[model samples]
Target: MVSGTGPETVPEAEFRSYYGHPVIKRPIWHVPHMPLYLYLGGLSGASSLTAVLAGLTGRHRLARAARITAALGASTGSAFLIAELGRPARFLNMLRVFKPTSPMSVGSWILAAQGGLSAAAAVSDVTGILPAVGDAAALATVVTGPLTATYTAVLVADTAVPAWHAGYRELPFLFAGSALASAGAAGMLATPRAEAGPARAVALLGAAVETAAATLLEQRLGLVGEPYRQGRAGLLLRVARALTAGGGLLTLLAGRSRVATAASGLALTAGALCTRFGVLEAGRASAADPKYTVVPQRERVETAGPASVPGR
Candidate 1:
Protein backbone atom coordinates (compact mmCIF):
# COMPACT_ATOMS: atom_id res chain seq x y z
CA MET A 1 0.00 0.00 0.00
CA VAL A 2 2.92 2.27 0.59
CA SER A 3 4.66 1.53 -2.71
CA GLY A 4 6.02 4.62 -4.48
CA THR A 5 8.29 5.21 -7.42
CA GLY A 6 10.56 7.42 -5.35
CA PRO A 7 11.42 7.44 -1.63
CA GLU A 8 10.11 11.04 -1.36
CA THR A 9 6.55 9.92 -2.33
CA VAL A 10 6.07 8.46 1.15
CA PRO A 11 7.98 11.41 2.53
CA GLU A 12 11.61 10.46 3.42
CA ALA A 13 11.00 11.94 6.88
CA GLU A 14 7.97 9.73 7.48
CA PHE A 15 9.67 6.48 8.43
CA ARG A 16 7.54 3.35 8.61
CA SER A 17 6.18 2.87 12.12
CA TYR A 18 5.86 -0.66 13.42
CA TYR A 19 2.79 -1.67 15.34
CA GLY A 20 3.00 -2.96 18.93
CA HIS A 21 4.31 -6.42 17.95
CA PRO A 22 6.44 -7.77 15.18
CA VAL A 23 4.48 -10.79 13.93
CA ILE A 24 1.24 -10.69 12.01
CA LYS A 25 0.12 -14.08 13.33
CA ARG A 26 0.61 -15.74 16.68
CA PRO A 27 1.94 -19.32 16.81
CA ILE A 28 -1.03 -21.51 17.71
CA TRP A 29 0.76 -24.50 19.16
CA HIS A 30 1.98 -24.83 22.74
CA VAL A 31 5.61 -25.10 23.79
CA PRO A 32 5.45 -28.73 24.92
CA HIS A 33 4.49 -29.93 21.45
CA MET A 34 7.43 -28.29 19.69
CA PRO A 35 9.93 -29.47 22.26
CA LEU A 36 8.35 -32.91 22.14
CA TYR A 37 9.13 -32.97 18.43
CA LEU A 38 12.71 -32.13 19.25
CA TYR A 39 12.79 -34.98 21.76
CA LEU A 40 11.26 -37.49 19.37
CA GLY A 41 13.67 -36.58 16.61
CA GLY A 42 16.63 -37.03 18.93
CA LEU A 43 15.25 -40.32 20.23
CA SER A 44 14.68 -41.69 16.75
CA GLY A 45 18.16 -40.81 15.59
CA ALA A 46 19.71 -42.27 18.72
CA SER A 47 17.77 -45.47 18.25
CA SER A 48 18.97 -45.80 14.68
CA LEU A 49 22.56 -45.45 15.77
CA THR A 50 21.92 -48.07 18.42
CA ALA A 51 20.49 -50.45 15.86
CA VAL A 52 23.46 -50.05 13.55
CA LEU A 53 25.91 -50.63 16.37
CA ALA A 54 23.97 -53.59 17.70
CA GLY A 55 23.80 -55.24 14.32
CA LEU A 56 27.48 -54.66 13.74
CA THR A 57 28.46 -56.09 17.13
CA GLY A 58 25.82 -58.85 17.22
CA ARG A 59 24.23 -57.25 20.29
CA HIS A 60 20.64 -58.22 19.64
CA ARG A 61 19.34 -56.76 22.88
CA LEU A 62 20.78 -53.35 22.16
CA ALA A 63 19.51 -53.66 18.61
CA ARG A 64 16.07 -54.49 19.94
CA ALA A 65 16.06 -51.41 22.11
CA ALA A 66 17.23 -49.33 19.18
CA ARG A 67 14.46 -50.61 16.94
CA ILE A 68 11.83 -50.08 19.62
CA THR A 69 13.12 -46.62 20.43
CA ALA A 70 13.16 -45.57 16.80
CA ALA A 71 9.62 -46.81 16.27
CA LEU A 72 8.28 -45.16 19.40
CA GLY A 73 10.15 -41.97 18.71
CA ALA A 74 8.85 -41.78 15.16
CA SER A 75 5.32 -42.52 16.30
CA THR A 76 5.36 -39.88 19.00
CA GLY A 77 7.02 -37.34 16.81
CA SER A 78 4.45 -37.81 14.04
CA ALA A 79 1.61 -37.34 16.48
CA PHE A 80 3.11 -34.12 17.78
CA LEU A 81 3.70 -32.82 14.27
CA ILE A 82 0.09 -33.51 13.34
CA ALA A 83 -1.14 -31.89 16.50
CA GLU A 84 1.00 -28.87 15.76
CA LEU A 85 -0.58 -28.62 12.32
CA GLY A 86 -3.89 -27.48 13.94
CA ARG A 87 -5.97 -30.13 12.14
CA PRO A 88 -5.02 -33.78 12.29
CA ALA A 89 -6.89 -34.88 9.17
CA ARG A 90 -5.44 -32.01 7.19
CA PHE A 91 -2.04 -33.56 7.75
CA LEU A 92 -2.74 -35.94 4.89
CA ASN A 93 -2.51 -33.02 2.49
CA MET A 94 1.21 -33.08 3.16
CA LEU A 95 1.39 -36.36 1.32
CA ARG A 96 -1.15 -35.46 -1.35
CA VAL A 97 1.71 -33.74 -3.13
CA PHE A 98 5.48 -33.48 -2.92
CA LYS A 99 7.76 -30.52 -2.99
CA PRO A 100 11.49 -30.76 -2.46
CA THR A 101 11.50 -27.08 -1.61
CA SER A 102 9.11 -27.85 1.21
CA PRO A 103 11.01 -29.26 4.12
CA MET A 104 7.80 -30.48 5.77
CA SER A 105 7.04 -32.67 2.78
CA VAL A 106 10.52 -34.19 2.79
CA GLY A 107 10.50 -34.60 6.55
CA SER A 108 7.07 -36.23 6.56
CA TRP A 109 8.16 -38.84 4.05
CA ILE A 110 11.40 -39.43 5.91
CA LEU A 111 9.50 -39.93 9.15
CA ALA A 112 7.00 -42.26 7.56
CA ALA A 113 9.73 -44.45 6.14
CA GLN A 114 11.66 -44.44 9.39
CA GLY A 115 8.59 -45.39 11.42
CA GLY A 116 7.61 -48.21 9.11
CA LEU A 117 11.09 -49.65 9.09
CA SER A 118 11.50 -49.31 12.84
CA ALA A 119 8.22 -51.10 13.53
CA ALA A 120 9.06 -53.87 11.15
CA ALA A 121 12.41 -54.36 12.81
CA ALA A 122 10.85 -54.42 16.29
CA VAL A 123 8.00 -56.74 15.34
CA SER A 124 10.54 -59.48 14.77
CA ASP A 125 10.50 -60.21 18.52
CA VAL A 126 6.90 -59.23 19.24
CA THR A 127 4.85 -61.12 16.63
CA GLY A 128 7.42 -63.86 15.88
CA ILE A 129 6.53 -62.94 12.35
CA LEU A 130 9.35 -62.73 9.78
CA PRO A 131 13.09 -62.67 10.36
CA ALA A 132 13.66 -61.57 6.78
CA VAL A 133 11.42 -58.57 7.30
CA GLY A 134 13.25 -57.73 10.48
CA ASP A 135 16.59 -57.85 8.74
CA ALA A 136 15.26 -55.70 5.94
CA ALA A 137 13.92 -53.23 8.46
CA ALA A 138 17.28 -53.13 10.17
CA LEU A 139 18.87 -52.31 6.85
CA ALA A 140 16.35 -49.55 6.22
CA THR A 141 17.04 -48.06 9.62
CA VAL A 142 20.67 -47.51 8.75
CA VAL A 143 19.68 -45.30 5.85
CA THR A 144 16.70 -43.49 7.36
CA GLY A 145 18.32 -42.94 10.73
CA PRO A 146 20.65 -40.19 9.59
CA LEU A 147 17.78 -38.47 7.82
CA THR A 148 15.75 -38.71 11.02
CA ALA A 149 18.60 -37.10 12.88
CA THR A 150 19.30 -34.42 10.31
CA TYR A 151 16.12 -33.50 8.36
CA THR A 152 14.73 -31.70 11.41
CA ALA A 153 17.17 -28.88 10.82
CA VAL A 154 15.75 -28.47 7.35
CA LEU A 155 12.20 -28.52 8.69
CA VAL A 156 12.93 -25.72 11.12
CA ALA A 157 15.02 -23.81 8.63
CA ASP A 158 12.23 -23.76 6.03
CA THR A 159 10.38 -21.32 8.19
CA ALA A 160 10.51 -17.57 7.67
CA VAL A 161 12.65 -17.44 10.77
CA PRO A 162 15.97 -15.91 9.74
CA ALA A 163 18.06 -17.46 12.47
CA TRP A 164 17.35 -21.06 11.56
CA HIS A 165 17.32 -20.71 7.77
CA ALA A 166 20.71 -19.07 7.87
CA GLY A 167 22.31 -21.91 9.84
CA TYR A 168 20.91 -24.65 7.61
CA ARG A 169 24.09 -26.51 6.67
CA GLU A 170 25.64 -26.56 10.12
CA LEU A 171 22.42 -27.38 11.96
CA PRO A 172 21.64 -30.60 10.05
CA PHE A 173 25.16 -31.99 10.44
CA LEU A 174 25.09 -31.00 14.08
CA PHE A 175 21.79 -32.78 14.76
CA ALA A 176 22.88 -35.93 12.92
CA GLY A 177 26.04 -36.15 14.97
CA SER A 178 24.18 -35.49 18.21
CA ALA A 179 21.61 -38.19 17.47
CA LEU A 180 24.30 -40.81 16.88
CA ALA A 181 26.07 -39.83 20.09
CA SER A 182 22.93 -39.95 22.23
CA ALA A 183 21.92 -43.41 21.02
CA GLY A 184 25.43 -44.77 21.36
CA ALA A 185 25.57 -43.40 24.88
CA ALA A 186 22.29 -45.12 25.72
CA GLY A 187 23.64 -48.37 24.29
CA MET A 188 26.84 -48.12 26.32
CA LEU A 189 24.78 -48.05 29.47
CA ALA A 190 22.59 -50.91 28.31
CA THR A 191 25.36 -53.21 27.03
CA PRO A 192 28.95 -54.22 27.64
CA ARG A 193 31.74 -51.89 26.49
CA ALA A 194 32.98 -54.46 24.00
CA GLU A 195 29.54 -54.44 22.40
CA ALA A 196 29.08 -50.73 22.94
CA GLY A 197 32.34 -49.71 21.29
CA PRO A 198 30.39 -48.32 18.34
CA ALA A 199 28.39 -46.24 20.76
CA ARG A 200 31.56 -44.66 22.11
CA ALA A 201 32.74 -43.89 18.61
CA VAL A 202 29.37 -42.33 17.81
CA ALA A 203 29.55 -40.16 20.90
CA LEU A 204 33.01 -38.91 20.01
CA LEU A 205 31.98 -38.20 16.42
CA GLY A 206 28.84 -36.41 17.53
CA ALA A 207 30.75 -34.21 19.94
CA ALA A 208 33.19 -33.19 17.25
CA VAL A 209 30.39 -32.45 14.79
CA GLU A 210 28.35 -30.52 17.36
CA THR A 211 31.33 -28.35 18.23
CA ALA A 212 32.34 -27.68 14.64
CA ALA A 213 28.78 -27.15 13.41
CA ALA A 214 27.99 -24.70 16.20
CA THR A 215 31.15 -22.75 15.53
CA LEU A 216 30.44 -22.67 11.81
CA LEU A 217 26.85 -21.63 12.43
CA GLU A 218 27.90 -18.66 14.48
CA GLN A 219 30.68 -17.62 12.15
CA ARG A 220 28.57 -17.94 9.03
CA LEU A 221 25.58 -16.06 10.39
CA GLY A 222 27.42 -12.83 11.09
CA LEU A 223 24.74 -10.28 12.13
CA VAL A 224 21.78 -12.26 10.76
CA GLY A 225 22.63 -15.10 13.10
CA GLU A 226 22.94 -12.78 16.08
CA PRO A 227 19.80 -14.16 17.73
CA TYR A 228 21.43 -17.54 18.30
CA ARG A 229 24.73 -16.11 19.47
CA GLN A 230 23.23 -13.88 22.17
CA GLY A 231 20.91 -14.06 25.21
CA ARG A 232 19.21 -17.37 26.07
CA ALA A 233 20.28 -18.98 22.80
CA GLY A 234 23.84 -17.89 23.47
CA LEU A 235 23.75 -19.47 26.92
CA LEU A 236 22.34 -22.72 25.57
CA LEU A 237 24.88 -22.85 22.72
CA ARG A 238 27.75 -22.31 25.17
CA VAL A 239 26.47 -25.15 27.31
CA ALA A 240 26.07 -27.39 24.27
CA ARG A 241 29.63 -26.67 23.19
CA ALA A 242 30.96 -27.47 26.62
CA LEU A 243 28.93 -30.64 26.91
CA THR A 244 30.02 -31.86 23.50
CA ALA A 245 33.66 -31.23 24.31
CA GLY A 246 33.49 -32.96 27.67
CA GLY A 247 31.47 -35.83 26.24
CA GLY A 248 33.90 -36.35 23.37
CA LEU A 249 36.72 -36.54 25.88
CA LEU A 250 34.80 -39.02 27.96
CA THR A 251 34.03 -41.10 24.86
CA LEU A 252 37.75 -41.24 24.04
CA LEU A 253 38.30 -42.70 27.48
CA ALA A 254 35.31 -45.04 27.21
CA GLY A 255 37.61 -48.05 27.40
CA ARG A 256 37.87 -47.11 31.07
CA SER A 257 34.48 -48.89 31.32
CA ARG A 258 30.69 -48.58 31.20
CA VAL A 259 30.65 -45.60 33.57
CA ALA A 260 32.75 -43.48 31.27
CA THR A 261 30.61 -44.47 28.30
CA ALA A 262 27.48 -43.63 30.24
CA ALA A 263 28.83 -40.18 31.10
CA SER A 264 29.70 -39.46 27.49
CA GLY A 265 26.30 -40.64 26.32
CA LEU A 266 24.55 -38.40 28.80
CA ALA A 267 26.62 -35.43 27.78
CA LEU A 268 25.89 -36.03 24.09
CA THR A 269 22.17 -36.40 24.79
CA ALA A 270 22.16 -33.14 26.72
CA GLY A 271 24.00 -31.44 23.90
CA ALA A 272 21.44 -32.66 21.35
CA LEU A 273 18.49 -31.49 23.41
CA CYS A 274 20.11 -28.14 24.02
CA THR A 275 20.86 -27.59 20.37
CA ARG A 276 17.28 -28.33 19.28
CA PHE A 277 15.55 -26.28 21.94
CA GLY A 278 18.03 -23.45 21.60
CA VAL A 279 17.47 -23.24 17.86
CA LEU A 280 13.72 -23.09 18.35
CA GLU A 281 13.96 -20.29 20.90
CA ALA A 282 16.39 -18.40 18.74
CA GLY A 283 13.97 -18.52 15.78
CA ARG A 284 11.17 -17.17 17.95
CA ALA A 285 13.39 -14.38 19.16
CA SER A 286 14.46 -13.47 15.65
CA ALA A 287 10.87 -13.27 14.51
CA ALA A 288 9.88 -11.16 17.52
CA ASP A 289 12.15 -8.30 16.59
CA PRO A 290 11.29 -5.67 13.98
CA LYS A 291 14.81 -4.35 13.83
CA TYR A 292 16.21 -7.66 12.70
CA THR A 293 13.84 -7.86 9.76
CA VAL A 294 13.52 -4.18 9.06
CA VAL A 295 17.18 -3.24 9.05
CA PRO A 296 18.04 -5.89 6.52
CA GLN A 297 15.19 -4.96 4.18
CA ARG A 298 16.07 -1.28 4.45
CA GLU A 299 19.68 -1.92 3.59
CA ARG A 300 18.64 -3.98 0.58
CA VAL A 301 16.34 -1.19 -0.68
CA GLU A 302 19.04 1.46 -0.23
CA THR A 303 21.50 -0.66 -2.14
CA ALA A 304 18.97 -1.33 -4.94
CA GLY A 305 18.27 2.43 -5.28
CA PRO A 306 14.96 4.13 -5.84
CA ALA A 307 12.39 2.42 -8.04
CA SER A 308 10.56 3.95 -11.04
CA VAL A 309 6.96 4.97 -10.48
CA PRO A 310 4.57 4.43 -13.41
CA GLY A 311 2.24 7.45 -12.85
CA ARG A 312 4.86 9.72 -11.26
Candidate 2:
Protein backbone atom coordinates (compact mmCIF):
# COMPACT_ATOMS: atom_id res chain seq x y z
CA MET A 1 0.00 0.00 0.00
CA VAL A 2 3.04 2.33 0.16
CA SER A 3 3.35 2.54 -3.67
CA GLY A 4 3.05 6.04 -5.13
CA THR A 5 2.65 4.77 -8.72
CA GLY A 6 2.48 1.51 -10.67
CA PRO A 7 5.54 0.49 -12.70
CA GLU A 8 3.86 0.94 -16.09
CA THR A 9 2.34 4.22 -15.02
CA VAL A 10 5.58 5.79 -13.81
CA PRO A 11 6.24 9.22 -15.23
CA GLU A 12 9.13 9.48 -17.67
CA ALA A 13 12.15 11.05 -16.06
CA GLU A 14 13.17 14.34 -17.62
CA PHE A 15 16.47 14.23 -19.46
CA ARG A 16 18.90 17.12 -19.15
CA SER A 17 22.37 17.86 -20.47
CA TYR A 18 25.06 20.53 -20.19
CA TYR A 19 23.42 23.44 -22.01
CA GLY A 20 22.13 21.09 -24.78
CA HIS A 21 25.47 20.34 -26.41
CA PRO A 22 25.78 17.31 -28.67
CA VAL A 23 26.62 14.31 -26.49
CA ILE A 24 28.62 12.66 -29.29
CA LYS A 25 31.46 13.84 -31.46
CA ARG A 26 30.61 15.17 -34.89
CA PRO A 27 32.23 13.69 -38.00
CA ILE A 28 35.60 15.25 -38.73
CA TRP A 29 35.36 14.62 -42.46
CA HIS A 30 35.70 17.71 -44.61
CA VAL A 31 33.04 18.82 -47.04
CA PRO A 32 33.25 17.89 -50.76
CA HIS A 33 36.06 15.40 -50.18
CA MET A 34 34.16 12.87 -48.07
CA PRO A 35 30.90 13.15 -49.94
CA LEU A 36 32.62 13.11 -53.29
CA TYR A 37 34.62 10.10 -52.22
CA LEU A 38 31.41 8.30 -51.34
CA TYR A 39 29.86 9.07 -54.70
CA LEU A 40 32.92 8.02 -56.66
CA GLY A 41 33.42 4.85 -54.66
CA GLY A 42 29.85 3.87 -55.30
CA LEU A 43 30.15 4.63 -58.97
CA SER A 44 33.42 2.69 -59.26
CA GLY A 45 31.98 -0.35 -57.50
CA ALA A 46 28.81 -0.49 -59.52
CA SER A 47 30.72 0.08 -62.72
CA SER A 48 32.99 -2.84 -61.95
CA LEU A 49 30.01 -5.06 -61.31
CA THR A 50 28.37 -3.94 -64.53
CA ALA A 51 31.57 -4.47 -66.47
CA VAL A 52 31.76 -8.05 -65.35
CA LEU A 53 28.11 -8.64 -66.20
CA ALA A 54 28.49 -7.05 -69.65
CA GLY A 55 31.63 -9.02 -70.43
CA LEU A 56 29.85 -12.23 -69.58
CA THR A 57 26.99 -11.28 -71.90
CA GLY A 58 29.20 -10.50 -74.93
CA ARG A 59 29.03 -6.69 -74.88
CA HIS A 60 32.77 -6.14 -75.35
CA ARG A 61 32.84 -2.38 -75.94
CA LEU A 62 30.46 -1.58 -73.11
CA ALA A 63 32.42 -3.85 -70.81
CA ARG A 64 35.69 -2.16 -71.81
CA ALA A 65 34.24 1.28 -71.13
CA ALA A 66 32.84 0.21 -67.78
CA ARG A 67 36.19 -1.26 -66.75
CA ILE A 68 37.87 2.03 -67.56
CA THR A 69 35.18 3.96 -65.73
CA ALA A 70 35.66 1.80 -62.66
CA ALA A 71 39.41 2.29 -62.81
CA LEU A 72 39.19 6.05 -63.17
CA GLY A 73 36.58 6.43 -60.48
CA ALA A 74 38.40 4.25 -57.99
CA SER A 75 41.70 6.00 -58.59
CA THR A 76 40.16 9.45 -58.26
CA GLY A 77 38.18 8.43 -55.21
CA SER A 78 41.31 7.11 -53.49
CA ALA A 79 42.97 10.43 -54.12
CA PHE A 80 40.05 12.19 -52.46
CA LEU A 81 40.23 9.89 -49.45
CA ILE A 82 43.95 10.42 -49.13
CA ALA A 83 43.45 14.15 -49.32
CA GLU A 84 40.79 13.93 -46.65
CA LEU A 85 43.31 12.34 -44.34
CA GLY A 86 45.36 15.50 -44.80
CA ARG A 87 48.62 13.61 -45.13
CA PRO A 88 49.43 11.48 -48.14
CA ALA A 89 52.32 9.88 -46.25
CA ARG A 90 50.00 8.57 -43.55
CA PHE A 91 47.93 6.54 -46.00
CA LEU A 92 50.00 3.47 -45.40
CA ASN A 93 49.23 3.61 -41.69
CA MET A 94 45.63 2.75 -42.51
CA LEU A 95 46.71 -0.76 -43.46
CA ARG A 96 48.93 -1.47 -40.46
CA VAL A 97 46.42 -3.73 -38.79
CA PHE A 98 43.27 -5.48 -39.84
CA LYS A 99 40.42 -5.01 -37.43
CA PRO A 100 37.12 -6.50 -38.43
CA THR A 101 35.46 -4.20 -35.92
CA SER A 102 36.74 -1.11 -37.74
CA PRO A 103 34.70 -0.12 -40.76
CA MET A 104 37.41 2.28 -41.84
CA SER A 105 39.97 -0.47 -41.92
CA VAL A 106 37.66 -2.73 -43.83
CA GLY A 107 36.86 0.00 -46.31
CA SER A 108 40.50 0.84 -46.81
CA TRP A 109 41.34 -2.73 -47.72
CA ILE A 110 38.34 -2.94 -50.01
CA LEU A 111 39.35 0.26 -51.78
CA ALA A 112 42.91 -0.93 -52.24
CA ALA A 113 41.72 -4.21 -53.71
CA GLN A 114 39.22 -2.48 -55.95
CA GLY A 115 41.76 0.03 -57.23
CA GLY A 116 44.22 -2.69 -58.14
CA LEU A 117 41.67 -4.91 -59.84
CA SER A 118 40.04 -2.10 -61.76
CA ALA A 119 43.36 -0.69 -62.94
CA ALA A 120 44.51 -4.09 -64.05
CA ALA A 121 41.28 -4.69 -65.91
CA ALA A 122 41.44 -1.32 -67.61
CA VAL A 123 45.06 -1.71 -68.64
CA SER A 124 44.39 -5.17 -69.97
CA ASP A 125 41.58 -3.86 -72.11
CA VAL A 126 43.73 -1.02 -73.43
CA THR A 127 46.95 -2.92 -74.12
CA GLY A 128 45.77 -6.50 -74.55
CA ILE A 129 48.35 -7.21 -71.89
CA LEU A 130 47.55 -10.45 -70.10
CA PRO A 131 44.02 -10.57 -71.44
CA ALA A 132 42.93 -13.60 -69.41
CA VAL A 133 44.49 -12.13 -66.28
CA GLY A 134 42.63 -8.89 -66.92
CA ASP A 135 39.37 -10.74 -67.38
CA ALA A 136 39.92 -12.57 -64.13
CA ALA A 137 40.72 -9.29 -62.42
CA ALA A 138 37.49 -7.80 -63.73
CA LEU A 139 35.55 -10.82 -62.53
CA ALA A 140 37.16 -10.55 -59.10
CA THR A 141 35.53 -7.15 -58.70
CA VAL A 142 32.17 -8.90 -58.64
CA VAL A 143 32.85 -9.74 -54.99
CA THR A 144 34.25 -6.39 -53.88
CA GLY A 145 31.89 -4.27 -55.97
CA PRO A 146 28.76 -4.80 -53.90
CA LEU A 147 30.74 -4.34 -50.71
CA THR A 148 32.13 -1.04 -51.97
CA ALA A 149 28.67 0.12 -52.95
CA THR A 150 27.24 -0.67 -49.52
CA TYR A 151 30.05 -0.40 -46.94
CA THR A 152 29.94 3.37 -46.87
CA ALA A 153 26.45 3.11 -45.44
CA VAL A 154 27.82 0.98 -42.61
CA LEU A 155 30.65 3.47 -42.13
CA VAL A 156 28.27 6.39 -41.71
CA ALA A 157 25.74 4.46 -39.67
CA ASP A 158 28.42 3.24 -37.29
CA THR A 159 29.10 6.85 -36.39
CA ALA A 160 26.98 8.72 -33.85
CA VAL A 161 25.27 10.89 -36.50
CA PRO A 162 21.58 10.61 -35.63
CA ALA A 163 20.22 10.84 -39.16
CA TRP A 164 22.73 8.35 -40.58
CA HIS A 165 22.52 5.82 -37.77
CA ALA A 166 18.76 5.98 -37.66
CA GLY A 167 18.50 5.23 -41.34
CA TYR A 168 21.11 2.44 -41.33
CA ARG A 169 18.84 -0.25 -42.72
CA GLU A 170 17.71 1.91 -45.60
CA LEU A 171 21.01 3.68 -46.22
CA PRO A 172 22.75 0.61 -47.64
CA PHE A 173 19.97 0.05 -50.12
CA LEU A 174 19.95 3.71 -50.98
CA PHE A 175 23.67 3.81 -51.64
CA ALA A 176 23.56 0.55 -53.61
CA GLY A 177 20.79 1.87 -55.83
CA SER A 178 22.61 5.14 -56.34
CA ALA A 179 25.73 3.23 -57.29
CA LEU A 180 23.82 1.26 -59.89
CA ALA A 181 22.32 4.40 -61.35
CA SER A 182 25.71 6.11 -61.50
CA ALA A 183 27.42 3.19 -63.18
CA GLY A 184 24.54 2.79 -65.60
CA ALA A 185 24.70 6.45 -66.52
CA ALA A 186 28.42 6.16 -67.24
CA GLY A 187 27.83 3.03 -69.32
CA MET A 188 25.09 4.65 -71.36
CA LEU A 189 27.20 7.72 -71.95
CA ALA A 190 30.24 5.79 -73.13
CA THR A 191 28.67 3.01 -75.19
CA PRO A 192 26.64 2.92 -78.38
CA ARG A 193 22.88 3.15 -77.89
CA ALA A 194 22.40 -0.29 -79.43
CA GLU A 195 24.67 -1.74 -76.77
CA ALA A 196 23.21 0.33 -73.94
CA GLY A 197 20.05 -1.70 -73.39
CA PRO A 198 21.28 -3.34 -70.19
CA ALA A 199 22.52 0.04 -68.95
CA ARG A 200 19.05 1.52 -69.46
CA ALA A 201 17.38 -1.30 -67.58
CA VAL A 202 19.88 -1.05 -64.76
CA ALA A 203 19.45 2.69 -64.53
CA LEU A 204 15.67 2.50 -64.30
CA LEU A 205 15.75 -0.24 -61.71
CA GLY A 206 18.33 1.66 -59.70
CA ALA A 207 16.28 4.86 -59.81
CA ALA A 208 13.25 3.00 -58.51
CA VAL A 209 15.23 1.42 -55.69
CA GLU A 210 16.91 4.71 -54.75
CA THR A 211 13.60 6.60 -54.77
CA ALA A 212 11.89 3.97 -52.65
CA ALA A 213 14.69 3.83 -50.11
CA ALA A 214 14.89 7.59 -49.83
CA THR A 215 11.14 7.90 -49.33
CA LEU A 216 11.16 5.17 -46.73
CA LEU A 217 14.15 6.73 -44.94
CA GLU A 218 12.45 10.09 -44.74
CA GLN A 219 9.14 8.63 -43.60
CA ARG A 220 10.37 6.08 -41.06
CA LEU A 221 13.10 8.15 -39.44
CA GLY A 222 10.65 10.42 -37.57
CA LEU A 223 12.35 13.50 -36.11
CA VAL A 224 15.80 12.26 -37.07
CA GLY A 225 14.82 12.45 -40.70
CA GLU A 226 13.92 16.13 -40.48
CA PRO A 227 17.40 17.21 -41.49
CA TYR A 228 16.90 15.59 -44.88
CA ARG A 229 14.03 17.98 -45.66
CA GLN A 230 15.28 21.28 -44.34
CA GLY A 231 17.65 23.92 -45.70
CA ARG A 232 20.38 22.96 -48.19
CA ALA A 233 20.10 19.27 -47.55
CA GLY A 234 16.41 19.41 -48.25
CA LEU A 235 16.90 21.28 -51.48
CA LEU A 236 19.49 18.80 -52.70
CA LEU A 237 17.41 15.74 -51.83
CA ARG A 238 14.33 17.27 -53.43
CA VAL A 239 16.25 17.93 -56.60
CA ALA A 240 17.77 14.48 -56.51
CA ARG A 241 14.35 12.91 -56.24
CA ALA A 242 13.01 14.90 -59.17
CA LEU A 243 16.02 14.11 -61.32
CA THR A 244 15.99 10.47 -60.47
CA ALA A 245 12.31 10.15 -61.21
CA GLY A 246 12.52 12.14 -64.42
CA GLY A 247 15.61 10.30 -65.56
CA GLY A 248 14.03 6.95 -64.92
CA LEU A 249 11.01 7.92 -66.99
CA LEU A 250 13.24 9.10 -69.80
CA THR A 251 15.14 5.82 -69.85
CA LEU A 252 12.15 4.18 -71.48
CA LEU A 253 12.66 6.36 -74.57
CA ALA A 254 16.45 6.76 -74.36
CA GLY A 255 17.17 3.83 -76.63
CA ARG A 256 15.41 5.64 -79.47
CA SER A 257 17.87 8.51 -79.80
CA ARG A 258 21.31 9.63 -78.73
CA VAL A 259 19.94 12.87 -77.34
CA ALA A 260 17.48 11.02 -75.13
CA THR A 261 20.15 8.65 -73.90
CA ALA A 262 22.61 11.43 -73.14
CA ALA A 263 19.94 13.51 -71.40
CA SER A 264 18.82 10.65 -69.20
CA GLY A 265 22.40 9.68 -68.38
CA LEU A 266 23.34 13.17 -67.37
CA ALA A 267 20.26 13.53 -65.20
CA LEU A 268 20.91 10.28 -63.38
CA THR A 269 24.57 11.15 -62.79
CA ALA A 270 23.70 14.55 -61.40
CA GLY A 271 20.97 13.04 -59.28
CA ALA A 272 23.38 10.49 -57.83
CA LEU A 273 25.80 13.27 -56.92
CA CYS A 274 22.99 15.23 -55.29
CA THR A 275 21.94 12.23 -53.25
CA ARG A 276 25.44 11.83 -51.79
CA PHE A 277 25.78 15.50 -50.97
CA GLY A 278 22.30 15.60 -49.50
CA VAL A 279 22.96 12.61 -47.27
CA LEU A 280 26.20 14.16 -46.03
CA GLU A 281 24.44 17.44 -45.33
CA ALA A 282 21.73 15.65 -43.44
CA GLY A 283 24.30 13.94 -41.22
CA ARG A 284 26.02 17.24 -40.61
CA ALA A 285 22.73 18.89 -39.74
CA SER A 286 21.86 16.11 -37.30
CA ALA A 287 25.23 16.51 -35.62
CA ALA A 288 24.77 20.28 -35.38
CA ASP A 289 21.50 19.93 -33.46
CA PRO A 290 21.77 18.79 -29.85
CA LYS A 291 18.13 17.81 -29.86
CA TYR A 292 18.70 15.05 -32.44
CA THR A 293 21.18 13.42 -30.10
CA VAL A 294 19.42 14.12 -26.81
CA VAL A 295 15.84 13.27 -27.73
CA PRO A 296 16.52 9.86 -29.18
CA GLN A 297 18.65 8.91 -26.21
CA ARG A 298 15.92 10.08 -23.87
CA GLU A 299 13.37 8.00 -25.72
CA ARG A 300 15.57 4.92 -25.44
CA VAL A 301 15.89 5.46 -21.70
CA GLU A 302 12.17 5.94 -21.34
CA THR A 303 11.44 2.75 -23.20
CA ALA A 304 14.17 0.53 -21.82
CA GLY A 305 14.81 2.00 -18.36
CA PRO A 306 17.81 3.95 -17.03
CA ALA A 307 20.07 0.92 -16.76
CA SER A 308 20.00 0.57 -20.51
CA VAL A 309 20.77 4.24 -21.09
CA PRO A 310 23.94 4.86 -23.06
CA GLY A 311 26.77 6.68 -21.38
CA ARG A 312 27.34 10.14 -22.76
What does each candidate score in C-alpha RMSD? 6.0, 5.6
Across 53-159, the per-residue lDDT of candidate 1 in tens digits comes to 77877777777767777788888888888888877776778887788888888877888888888888888856678988888887878888888888887777766
lDDT of 2 by residue, 1-312 (tens): 246664455577654456865666777888899989999999999999889888878899999999999999999999999999998766778888888999999998998899999999999999999999999999999998888888999999998899999999999999999999999999999999888777777788889999999999999999999999998999999999999988888888664788988999999999999999999999998888888888888788899875644785
Taking all chains together, each candidate's TM-score versus the true structure is: 0.84, 0.91
Alpha-carbon runs more than 4 Å astray in model 1 = 1-17, 23-29, 125-128, 301-312
| CA-lDDT, candidates in order | 0.75, 0.91
